[model samples]
Every structure is written in C-alpha cells, then in structure tokens.
Target: MDFNFLSPVSDLVLAHNALLSSQALGSKLRIHSKNQGIPDLDAVGIAIIGVLENRNDVNYIGEEFNLNEIRKSFYGLFPGSWSSVVADLGDIEKGERVEDTYFALKSIVSALLKLNIIPVIIGGTQDLTYATYRAYDDVIPMVNIVNVDCKFDMGDSSKPMKNNSFVGKIILDEPYNLFNYATIGYQTYFNSQEEIDLMDQLYFESYRLGEVSNDISLVEPAVRDANIVSIDLNSVKGSEVSLNQKFSPNGLDGKEICAIARYAGISNKVTSLGIYEYKPSKDDEMTAMLVSQMLWYFIEGVNLRVRDDDFADENSYQKFITLVDSQELIFYKSNKTGRWWIEIPFLADVNNKLKRHTLLSCTHQDYIDACSNIIPERWYKAFRKNSV
Candidate 1:
C-alpha cells in the first residue's frame, strides 16, 4: 500500500482528490519513519482502521465520498505530540475493496495484538462496534462497555447495514454484561421506554445532552474497568458532524464533546476504539477538519495515559497464548450440537492465534490466579458446567 495512493485500487481517478493530497501528499511533507522518527510522536503502539467507503445505491450504508478526507486531514495532526500512536490502518478502503469488513478488521486486530499496539478503528457504519468490540472481548474480564450515541440502536432484524439498529442486536447477540451499559449525549427523543427500563434494570447510566449542559459526570463510570471504548460520532448533534443520522442544533458543543472523548481516552483499560457515521456527503471542510482535530485530542489523552509509568508496560489488555506448546491442543465445538471437540493435539505454540481471542473464567477461584497472566479471568454469578 502506497502512502500516497490507496491499494486494491479504485476506479476513481486522481482528479477526484482534494483534502490531504493538496497540502500533505506532495514532496514538501514526509511521513516520519523509524530512522528519523516523528517530530512529536514515536508511535511505539498504533494501527489505523477505516472500514467505510462511499457506496452506490446497492449498498446498505451509502454515503458520499468526501468523508475519506478525514484520513488525509488527520495525518496533518501527526506531529502534535510525542509517543502519540501511529495511524497504521489508513490503507484499508471502504466497500468493494474488502468483503466482510468485520473479518478484515479482526485480522488487523490480531496482528496488532501480537505487536502490543493500540488500535484506533474508524467507521464502516455504527455496526463496526460488533467486530471491534469482539476482537478484545476474549481478552479482558470486568470490561466496562459504553455506548456514546443518540440512538440505542435497538434494530435487530439481522440484515446487513440497517446502520444503527443492529448495534443493539450485536450486543444482545453476544453475551456482554448488560450492567456495563452506559450511554451519553442522547436527547429525550432518542430514548424509548423499553430501552430505559433495560438500562434501569441493569444499572445502565445515561445522560441526555439536551437537559444537561456539561455533565462531565456522565462519562466516568462507563470507563472504570473498560478494556475497549466504542465511540459513535452521532452522539453529538448531527449539526456538529455531517456523518450523523440525525443532525441537531441542540447537541453537546465542541468543547464538551472533546472533553468527553479525552476523558474516555484516559481509561487504563481502553484498548480498541471506533468512530462511525463519518459520511462525507453530509460533511464540509469545517466538519471534516474539526473531526480530525477531535481525533488528535483523543489520541493525545490516550498517549499521555499510556506513557505514564504505571501504564507504560500495560498497553494491551490481551495476555498469554493458548495451544502454546507442542504438547497442547486446540479444539472447537460442533455447530449444531455445540459440543467441544479436539483437534491438533500436538502442535507447537510458536505463534497461536487461537489463544489471542479465548478468555477463560473457570468455576473455581484458584483458576483465576492460575490463568490471570494469560487467559483473563472473572467471577461468574452462575456457572454453566460446559461453558468456557
């Protein structure tokens, strides 16, 4: 993948280029590499993730092209800090370039985890949450999951790209703690009775940006033990971000939005992050430019926290390897019967990908400490005899 032009190639021509190419693409700017190093950030840990590309009528989440500008514009913010993460996945394109963005993202996440780099995942739609969160789910326990969006995304019909609704579907589809739910920046209209009731029953917390002006209190608890943070740009008024589904004049102002993001970035456990609905068709230079800046601030906060002495060696929440020795075996369950079966009992553990995503929570308390360094452990209220 060339730093200048995207690969897997696009039929679109050079004449179509604007934002990043105009200023930074030429000879005047050069990406700082290992030898020279970046002026501000060393990029000890990072990866870039862009899952969305502007689509035509056939696609589910169709939005105009200008949105890609964020990637280009964001590079300009590159040197604003030291040890700030390098945006590694910028080469990933939207739409036709890749099939099943979720799968591709997992591969990228897997590679990064091996490197111990923090991944900053960009949009393909709010649906990116399912895959991004899924990548780290197997690594950490007591995860604090938070959704920063206006809509609860309760749509679960299962068709691809219903855009926002499936967000609820995936969370429900997977088994994360419902008690971990916390939402911010939702206006009154976006809340429904059932959604509220569920949140209440689970002790889920939310703050309506409409009524509260600067309730910074809304952001804290959601990140306490979080190993990942899911950011939906639509959490702010669509007026602030063109990619938003519902734009409004009543959204949280620019200052508050960054503060919240910065706050989220400070969490010790936030490993992977995603930002969605960056549809360029609805965007302008101001919107495009501002978002890139917002990203810079968020990264800055994460960098500061990561660089701190306590967290310096704790970048990734993922730990240990499974099927690690030639003596160990890897297995899977039958799709229909759901019964565990063994495979490859005598393979070397030189580099096992299976261990990267399998979290272990044994029925016994002693199991927690035994596997604590490798498989993340948790205390379960109820134990399923066969569940791993």
Candidate 2:
C-alpha cells in the first residue's frame, strides 16, 4: 500500500491532545454538533478532527481525488485546543498487517467507548472490516452488521487478507446469524455471478437500486437494526464523488445515502462505524465537502436520538416497539448455525424467545452483537439515573 506523506495540517497531534484533555474522560458524551459542536463553534473548535487525509484509491469517472487541502480546511473546525487520531501502517509483511491493523482498530473503538468521541477512519482499503468487528466485539455481542455498498465485496482470497476479499473471508470463516447482515445499492455489472449467488444464499436482506424504487423504506428496517455500519462510497451512484473501482451509474443518490446515515446515527446502535473508499485523489471540491457534511449529519442524527429522552410512561417505547415489529423481514437460516439466532427488538416484542433479556445482564459486547436492538448499558443506566 502506498502512503501519501502530504498531511496538510501538521499540528494534528497537538489538537488531538487538547480535545482529549478537555473531556470528562469517563462519563457519557454531553457535547454534540447540535448543541455546541465538539469543543464549541463559538471558537475554532472543529479543526481538531482536521479533514480526511488524501491518498490513492479508485473513484467515479475513473480518476483519483486528493483531499489534502480540504483536510486542512476542516482543521479549522477545531478550536486551538483539539486533535484527531491518525493510524498509519507503514510497509509490513502480509501476515502481520491484519493483526497490526486489528490492534490499531481495536484501540480506536475502545477509545470511542471510553472517551465518548466519534472516530472517522481513512482506509488502507476494506479489510478494515476485520478491525472494526474485532473492536466491536470488545464492547458488544450478538449485534447486527450493515453494509451500504454497491458490491458484495466478497472477493476470493487464499488467506485472511485485505482489499476486496475481506468480506468473503468473513462469510467463509464465520457461522453467521444470516439475518444479522444486510447489503444495499449493488449494481448489476460490478459483481460476478458466483459472488452474486453466494450473496443471495444468505438470510440477510439486500436492496438493489436497479430493482427497487428510490424510497429507502424498502430497506430502512435493516439499517435501523444494525449495531455496526460499514459504508463504502462505491455504494453511491457513478458521480464525481464515488472513488472506487467497479462503480456504476445507477446506484444510490447522495441524499438517499445521507438519509440512511442519519437513520443509523439516530438509532444509536452503531457502536463501531466506518465509511470507506473515499479516494481523495479523485474527489473534486464538492465531493470532498459533501463527505464531511454527510458524516456530520449522521453524527447529529445519532446525537439527537441519544439525547431525546423516552420512558415506558411516555409511550415512546410503545411507538418504537410497534414501528420496529411492523417492518418486513426475510429470514434465512444456514445449517449448523448456532444454538440461538437472535434479534433484539427492545420493547417491540418482549415475548420473543430471542428477544427479551435479563435486564442489565448484557455486557457492552452483548449489546453490540445485538445491534440496534439492545439498549446500550449507558442508555439504560442514564435513563434510570435521570428518572431518579
């Protein structure tokens, strides 16, 4: 993998430290873009996270877009006292890269859970999926995984590897609760027949843009149910913004993609999240700017969801339960699956064998495994605490 050494904003480390020092360091997040921004828009508070570092990757129109400059502009969002995390993988042997990436990946997710900070990872490519799941496992168990992309990304590889093959490796290696996974916006030509076949065999839901209407309601239930979200920009239609090979013209519109992003955020089931394949080299000015805006809106949605208070008394729980239970789902079962195949519906269906739980019995890992369904321990505790 070739690394571009051109980081436009050089004081990122300094800014990162300032943000870290200001936080309570142990409590749940109290700040949000809707409220005061990360550190405060009253000052230069957004600059700390900086903009995304630009490098090489495939994008729409078959070109590379360099984002180094926008990254500099984004740094302006942070105040004088903020910072972002940059994990670099210099040249390492193939066997070592996966484990090494896992280490950095795990640490970042751990920090998110610990510090209440949102992390945006720029890629070495899609194998980051391995790192994302490993870290998520640390905090939650039996959760849903959602991929909003144009390809199954289930490429063939001989061993545990990176690039496109990681998705295939995950499918091959794990005995999944097929219902726990979902894919969207896949274009016809971008995938091979065999890849297409395997993807269909799974129990998870899929929404091909060519086959369905523009309304996301066809697939909104699964997205709402996800515990972790892995969004590949290739899922977007063939526009100047999509920076990945095998892209297609008739994919998802940006507005639709952002709608799903907002939905994922508001559900707050996303414990570990990533949006990959944004080739800075191919993206023009508008594309780069939209990336930041799209991501910010997603966070804002989640912040709104988490901040909005609800109780068993107010009927929000009842409304949520009814809404969730009403969604149409196609179930798939792969033999020799596990003892239990679960879906967490909160108050939606308490009598479900796979639904109800010993209250507060779940660890962070358990909640993540259940995805959008399980209440985060913090949410439960805080709701109870505030109610008291």
Candidate 3:
C-alpha cells in the first residue's frame, strides 16, 4: 500500500529499546518504517496516526510542531489484557498548504475506517477534527459528534476556519451530515453567551465543566451515542501538563479526561477519535504520560465492548413503556451492560434522515422521569431534530 501522505517514524525512535526489565508497548506494536512498509489492517483493531500541523492553534505563533514525546511516552507503557492488534501508522507531516494536510488526513482516516480499524489521532491542532468529521461525510449519511473541550469551538463560520472555529465549518458545510453535536467539560467562562444560546436553540447538548467534573458518568451516555469523538488537550488544567500554553486553570483533570476517553472507546457507535491541541515543551514527560494513559484507557474500553445493538432479542434487553404527558415512551435496558435507551418516534408525514423511530441513549433517571409524566430532555430534543 502506497500512502503518499504518510512519513514513517524515524529509525532512532523505533529502534530505541534501551529500557530493560520491562514489557513495553513498542515490542507489541506493528509500526510503520522504511523496511516494514504498511502494517496489515486485517490484523489490526486500532491505528495511531499523528498529524504535525499546529498553524491553527491559538497559542502557536511559529512553525514548530512535534509528537515525538508522545510516541516515546506511549511506547514505553506496558500492555494490558488486550487481544486487539495496534499499529502506529507514523505521522502526516504538515503539507505546503493546510488544505493539503486536511486532504491527506481525510483520505487516510476514511481508508482506515473502511477496514474496521479505529484511528487514534494525536494532533497538533483541534481543528483537524473538522477533517476527521469530513472523512465520514460520504460513508455515513448522518453522524453525531462529541467534543471534549473547554470551549464550544463554534466560531464564525463566515470567517476563515481555525482551531477554535472548525465546528462552525462542520455545521455550515455541504451534505449536512451532522445529526447531533455534544460538548463535554465546556467552561461557562470560555464560551460567549451567543454560542451558549445557539447550542440551546439548535437543541444540541452541552455539559458544563463543573457538571462533568462533578459526575464523570454523565459523559458516558453522550459519548455512547456519538459516532466520532474529539478531545482538545486544552481542556485539561495547567497543573497536569508540562506545556503551559495548552493548559487551562480550571478544566478537566487528568483522571476525568482519561475516564471520558474510555467512555468514548466503549461506545459501539464511535469509529474515530482525535486528541489535539498538545504543545510539547522541553519537559513534556508528564504531558506525554497523561496522553499515553488516556490512550491505554480507551483501548481497555474498546476491548470490553459488548455487542448489545440487537434490541429485538428479548433475552438481551428488558422493555419498559411509560406515558409522559399522554405520550408513549419506550425504554430498553441492555442485560449485558445495564445501559438504558429511549425510543424517539418519528411522524409518518415527516421527512427525516433517521428512521421512523430511533433509540437515544439515556439514563435510568430519564426512565424514572418518564414514569412521573415528565418528558426527558433527550427525547424532546431528538423528537424536534428528527423533524424536517
């Protein structure tokens, strides 16, 4: 396979196995190199692709960009009880133009997805998520995006796109493939009032940094329902990262972000994940270690995935019907995972991209609210969004 867009990892990094008396990930991974060519996708479950493009990062004023620290930190970690094969597809160097880089990333990610290989992207700028989302435009008719960040990143779509404004581009672009957009760990101070208002008006979801930090489990349902998940490292507090530019004074902590990544990985619907906005400094060991652990948790979650998509089987789920304000709401609980989902019915005359009815991931609390004659916010939003 000729991947014109990719540049293999340096032999120095691949050959750096000096550490002794330890089982490291470098020993297990099938890495892209001058001699190895490309790894067999059929035998791989996840592929790590690094994008060294940071022109859009708000803090990056120059041309320097790297993910070498991340590779060194990640490759040194020991593997868990994981049976899935992983490959490091090397880095996509910054092209002459930013658009060229986007095109390469889109092509690579699309190809990997077709092979049922999840691409774990470590990126220089969060805006690369726009390219990741575009890769699925033709492959899937509709997609749900989950962004773990401190800001909404929905800048003025009318202006030139940047790291902070790419979500707006995704919304305004052609095909209109976005079904739902959800944000986790967003700080109220970072986003403008207009952006916050827009999220509510569009019937999209936004969870505050306080809310998710207080209850990390709240992110699971949002991530579980998403097809693509993007995490901006700037969402992490400054104390956790060695690079101060990419850190925040009050955002998600290290543990919370890793837990969120695991939630994303456990979701059967999620196909691609990108971690961006990392700024490597001279002392980047701590930052790289955190990123490595986050990746470890995500892989752990993927290995623990249960096939509970089949709700038709009575043996796999328990059904419950509740009447909320005279409207019927059907809920299903997965026997395998104890997860809950509510069905949102579509009107027959309505032209919707979704089917006649769709199952929206919910919590047991939502089911209880329905029993008390209260419609869950999730159901109401899905009901309205499904309308043409």
Deviation of model 2 at 108, angstroms: 1.8
lDDT of each: 0.50, 0.47, 0.88
Give the C-alpha lDDT of model 1.
0.50
Highest lDDT, which number?
3
lDDT of 3 at 83: 89
lDDT of 3 by residue, 1-388 (tens): 3478889887777766445224788888888888887776778999999999988766567868677778888888888899889999999999998899999999999988888899999998999999999999778899999999899999999988899999999998997899999999999889999999999888899999988988899778889999899999889988888965455689889899999999988999999999998887878888899999999999889998998868778899999998887889999999998999999887888787786678999999899888888898888888888885
On TM-score, the candidate that comes out on top is 3
Give residue 319's error in model 2 in angstroms: 8.0
Relative to the unseen true structure, what is the C-alpha lDDT of residue 291 in candidate 2, on a scale of 0 to 100?
A: 60
- Give every collision pair in model 3: none
Please give, for residues 267-365, the per-residue lDDT of candidate 2 as tens digits.
545555676666555435555555655655565565555422223243332111212224421111212211111223244423332344212112223
For every model shown, what is its TM-score relative to the native structure? 0.63, 0.59, 0.97
Which is better, 2 or 3, measured by TM-score? 3
Q: How far is each candidate from the true structure, as Cα RMSD in Å?
A: 12.9, 12.6, 1.4
